[model samples]
Target: MFDRFIDYVAKVAPDKIAIRSFEGSITFAAMNRDINRLAHALLDVIDNSSEIVAVNYKQVHIHWMLLMALSRIGVASASVSSNSEIAEKEIAILQPDAIISDTLFDIDTAAKIHVLDLNWYDQAMKRFKPDPIYTLYEPDRIVRVSIAAGTSFMRHRIDYTASMIESSVIRMITQEKISWSLMSEIPRYPTLLPTLAFGSFHGFLCYLSIWSIGGTIIMADREQYFAAIAMLSPDLMVISPAQLQLIAENLPEDIPRQDHLRLIVVAGNFPNGLRHFVQQRLTKNLNVTYATSEAGVIASINIDQINHDDTAGWIMPWIDVQVVDDQDHPLTYGEIGNIRIKSPNIVQKFFQNVQDTHKQFKNGWFYPGDLGILNEEGLLRLIGRVDELYNFGGDKFYANKIDAVICSIEGIKDAALFSMPDNDGIQQPWLAIVRGGNFDIDQIARLLEKEFYNLPDVSVLWVNSIPRDEEGHVLRNHLEKLAMQYIETI
Candidate 1:
């Protein structure tokens, strides 16, 4: 697994920093040693009884080390979060052969499941001599299990073989234009801050990409988002769109925008009218990307290459993207339909989730269930989800059609139009908005009337912020709940 890459990086830049947290930091050389020592310690205590090991903790280095250690011993690993709202449910579904977590947390599991406290692994790894006796690679064996980032909790397990993960990592390096060289002085992303959630798939990929080249991964979870940026001076920062909004809105006036940053990659869509402000406040190198848990990197476009608003950049050369009709046939260019992605490394099916696998994975293509359009030139534009279609007496259209028009109104920071059933059980349109200081609620009605066709009377639901998942998808259920509460209050 990572041991070989670590060994290679150690050979080149052993002295360079590898992982950094508030507690401490480790160099590539020392990290390699520690991983090997931990692998040997795990080798003694671990057996084939547990099919998959779940690594659950906030200790960044420890979590990472445990993952790589399990990989070295040819045992698959799943990154489980102790703080996940459905931690117990996740553990039950995973039914992990074993769980490695902090002793302070109580994660009840079956008596058959091995639960190794991190303190014990730490002590044992320190005392035992290290032997780098690890299987270098297993192409067919599953090496990692990443939970899908859909269906609210995104609990559906997605499995990856060693080859699939390697391919995905290489694709990331290629798409991100990561420079690789033997000369250590070139400084390849020396210090990095990734704003994606720690245990998420993209976050794991971010860490691996940085460590593949022996760069510093700053686990600054304890500090405020922008505060960490000021204190660490990271050369590269990887943020999701939601995190981008938080930093853009909350950053202090005194702190200067990061113009000197080597790169700033947004892992998901950049909302309409956001690029200009983000470029002015954050780094100008805002690399926009679109990816899925089933499908790997679908498309990526550098900020400089962008030519349109609300675009998901260009589809990857290796991937085939098509907007399809209801029957799963392809739709012509510029027409919005379900986005079906086909790539070499796309996951075959969900792990232990038969219903989802049947619905999503078919004939090497993964139907992500999101509405989107592909232009003739291969540019992708994402619309809302299939379940979000507004049914106006059986004439259905994606709700984002109205949203895209509504966002044209000035001072409207963010807006999502949702379909909610009225007291009579008829579906009605409801607008949830996060207004900027200069926005006018009345203006939304006026502008929407002019641009929209036969638009229904939209009830307004004012919210301080639009609730979204880490992936930047609007949490429509939460929005509807807020809307319901607002109706009750008024």
Candidate 2:
């Protein structure tokens, strides 16, 4: 479905810089040629009737190239984690026809596998340069699959098709394109230097959306991101809250006023101080996007759109977002309940897992495991996860807000609110903190008092680090295990 778009861009601006990877850079025309060559070359290695191919390469740059090539062959593609254990789990769940990795294969598997090493691309190019046009894949056929991150030992698969991918790009880019200049100081094609990952859904969509307009992608490691920003003077930055914190920490005393940037912070429900910190140091033209893997960008808003607000922004007209009661009945506006979503991009259920499929998907609506409120004016306020809503001493503690407040304080690196039931089977809240120097632990009490007057007494557990997913979501299950281990040591 997207083949024509790539060909059009390659012809229109052949010399345009497409992607700048850690290894090197590639132009639109050259990248297009490589994609074509790789597609043709893979015909011999991958089975003709292959359904899924899991690519686990050390370099993310290689992952992007391989996935695109596999997509061209009308075979489903998934980015397997680099860690051997996680990669095994992902491959097991996918039950792919082929497994392609950069290292030697040792895990026993019945599927056809290949270890192509670092010189894989160079080898593939030498094999074939055929100029053959293949049939376009059906819009409904699954083209890509993403493994959802959480505390689960085995992650669930989120599948995507051409139609679903197109809807995501359209909702995230095309619809918002009209409101670009009117609402913010950013340009229509805000992709001068965007750090994107094709492994994740939103990151992939962000990269694809920018590519649709022939925008440049700068793929750098997390450590090199700040340096890349300083060097590139990026026009756009699509980053998570954790990444934003790193940026805030590394920025020099004299903040460069980048008036042209349109920084979009994903998975955000941050404190106002952190928001101000970003506007002051990074750019005032900031966009906080609240999104889910199943559904695309649900709601996003500019910094100046609201006053002292951390809302995900006004609801996107393309999506049906509702705050529903526990019984699946829709709640009235301004009431807090489960956030359920329905959109063209949404998959009704997980790819193969029946247990989670029934748990998360129901009656064509995807429950993103979030508790939130939708106001009458179409504004969405995400409180936290439904499972993270802890009741202690007759008071509720929002896990997201708890961490937001904790992490907002100076010298607090990362924080997560997790719980474990006592011997009496009563739930108790524990605040796992990864504190930096110069922050007093007592200040947490003062901050909690100001945020919630009737809050429960939350135990503070100091740890070296708090576990997190790629998007910076807290891993409660991990934290719980850590807490148990800490107790055993004591």
Candidate 3:
């Protein structure tokens, strides 16, 4: 798959920029040569053993090159980062045959496994020959494996083969009309919206689609979120909903040539506040997509529709989506139920997790654990997660409603609400909020009282900031701890 795109680009546009990072940029021809040399050097490391390797690298080029090299040898590649103890534990769980990283890890160095640092590997690969042999690998062999972030140890892994990768890119081009022509005078550059550690399936698909179209990938230090976008006048950008919040917060009053951005592709849950910000501030056309790590791209809704409708967008062409009840029977339109998707882009299996594999992957349908309604307009209006529903005195409600209401308030930046037992053992709602300004707790409580009558007693705590994972998801457990500590004092 890599060869098909990289080779074609190298022949037609050798000087075209393929990847640009903080350190420097590399051309298509040079990137292809480096991938070949790296693959040759990896042969010695593997020593004829067919094994999946875990690559934890800081550089964007290294991540792409390593994956390309591994694919050439028919070995699967899993990208991990040394971000947290949870991430480190997940990598250890993989027990990769070889751990190729820029920094040292705490895993046991078994004799069979090859552990090489980037500094040493870089020097070693320099002396190797650049002869790419893409024919050695079968298309059905697993090419990439990524885990769902924010799941902690439940880090469910999704395996993708070369054919899946190729098909996903094709879907992007045909379904979304995201294409680039060699005849066009304008340059098509795709800026990376997420870090390699997150390894979001949508982000990876965007990366592959951009490369397939011979477009340049612009990436920078993950820490320099706003600065990177300002520096690189990217034609297209793929960002997550969480990252969009960061962009909205950091946007300057006036940016030079900011209107040059043509498209902004967002994946994952779309919050109302984010939609409002994007619609009012950013002039670029917004494309909101609904996809899971298990399934590549399920559905999407573009700007005007997204701004107007409270749905995840229309289902993608050729995808079979069903809103089913507990019995797996399909529900009528406008009925809220569990969402199940069947598509060629769905992962074949969750590596090494038999229980999850059986529970989630059933009858060729992958249950995404989301509760939503398919409206008459054919749009999926996501209500909440089925598993996250909590009961208070036999009344069931999703915390997302609490979050949505609080976040929608004028003086609230972010908030999280979860059910917890009080001193009386009655389940009550507890809220933690990051103040956007001088928010009045009594006024907010009064507003919520109008929505849900007899709302359970809620304890509110004002915090400087809400803790979130790298993906921008609120860390519920961490917030619970803080709430507990405050409750103890009260």
Candidate 4:
């Protein structure tokens, strides 16, 4: 479906730089040739069947090329990190026909399956030089399978169709006004620089969106991101709130301002005050995007909304968003309910899990496990997750609301609020605060009492930092375990 876009750029501007990494830059023409060679070489290792192929390589530069090659041949692809143990577990569940990586594993089942080391794969592809002709994949075929994070034992898969990938590109062009088409007056395409994991949906989409416009992607590790940005001067960037806070705290005053930069923050409810701080210091515009692995890029609010309004954003043109009740009945404006979505860009189903498919995908609408409300103007205000809504002695409340309020307090750098079971198996509200300077626990307790008059059995912990994943999501289960250990020790 997107073969035309890549081929067009290779034809029109063969010399244009497509990717820029620490190693070097590769042009559109060269990328096309390399992908063609890789696609042809892949045929020898994997069969023509629709079975998925798992790739766990250390060299991040080869991921995009491998994905394009997989798409070209009509085979679904799943990527895990270079950790052999995690790869072995995923291989057991996914049962991929081929496993491509930088090193070999010791799993007995892998002996029968084709295992192509990336170094060997590249050397072999070098043997097949010129473009190899191959049949294109159908639009409705599954091309990519993505895994969800925060699961220590189980890995859940979300399958993306070829049509869905194409639609995602179209949505980026139409909604973001980011493109290099002749109709656009903008002379240069945007360069995306992300510090997230390579296997993440956000990271993959960032690379794909840039490639769709024949733009550049600068690869950098989290520690090297700030230093690399100074040299690369990327026009587009995506980050988590944790990264934003890191920049706000440590960034030097003498760093050059990137006038062309457009920064996007994903996966959190960014307070308006912090949004202003980031825009003034880091970039010209700040976009807070609310989305999920199942439904990609649901909505994005720009600097105007970030400054003036309290909203995630109005629904994007690609999605049909609704606030529905438990019975799947549509709710009226300003009524808080489950946020359900219908979009062509969303995944059709889980790869092999029937229970998760039925739970998440229902009646053609994907419930992203979020609670929200839509105003009369169609603006979306996401409440906490329905599952995260805890009951304190018959009073229901969202933990994120408490977390946001506590984070707003003076001298509080970060906060995590959740319920933990006590000795009697009764769950109680607990607050963990990361202090920036001198913090008054008494004053915070008074504030909480003022907010909830009957609130009792509330405990507070002052920690240096909160436990979080690579994507900056709070690791609640890990935190709960730590809290239990702390309580027992005390």
lDDT per residue for candidate 3 within 341-389, as digits (tens), equals 8987577567787877777789999887778888766687777666556
- Work out the TM-score per prediction: 0.88, 0.91, 0.89, 0.89
The lDDT values for all models are 0.73, 0.76, 0.70, 0.72
Candidate 4: clashing pairs of residues: none
| Cα lDDT of model 1 by residue, 288-372, tens digit | 7887777767887777666665567788888998899988999899897888888887888877778878788778788887778
Q: Please name the candidate that would achieve the greatest lDDT relative to the true structure.
A: 2
Say which prediction, candidate 2 or candidate 4, comes out ahead on TM-score.
Answer: 2
Compared with the true structure, what per-residue lDDT tens digits does model 4 show for residues 1-490? 3445666688888998888877778888888888788887877777666368777777676766776787667677877767778667666666666767667667745423455666667686678765655556577776767776312313576667777777776676665573222232342577788766656666677777777787888877767777777887777777877777787788778776655677777754676667767777777666777767777778877656553333677677778999999899999998989888997656757767787778778988988777888888767887767666778888887777778778878889899887798779888888888898877767788788788666666887767789876566666666677788888898
Locate the minimum summed-lDDT window of 10 residues in model 1: 178-187
Looking at model 2, residue 57 earns an lDDT score of: 91
Best of the candidates, TM-score = 2
- Better by TM-score, candidate 3 or 2: 2
Better of 3 and 4 by lDDT: 4
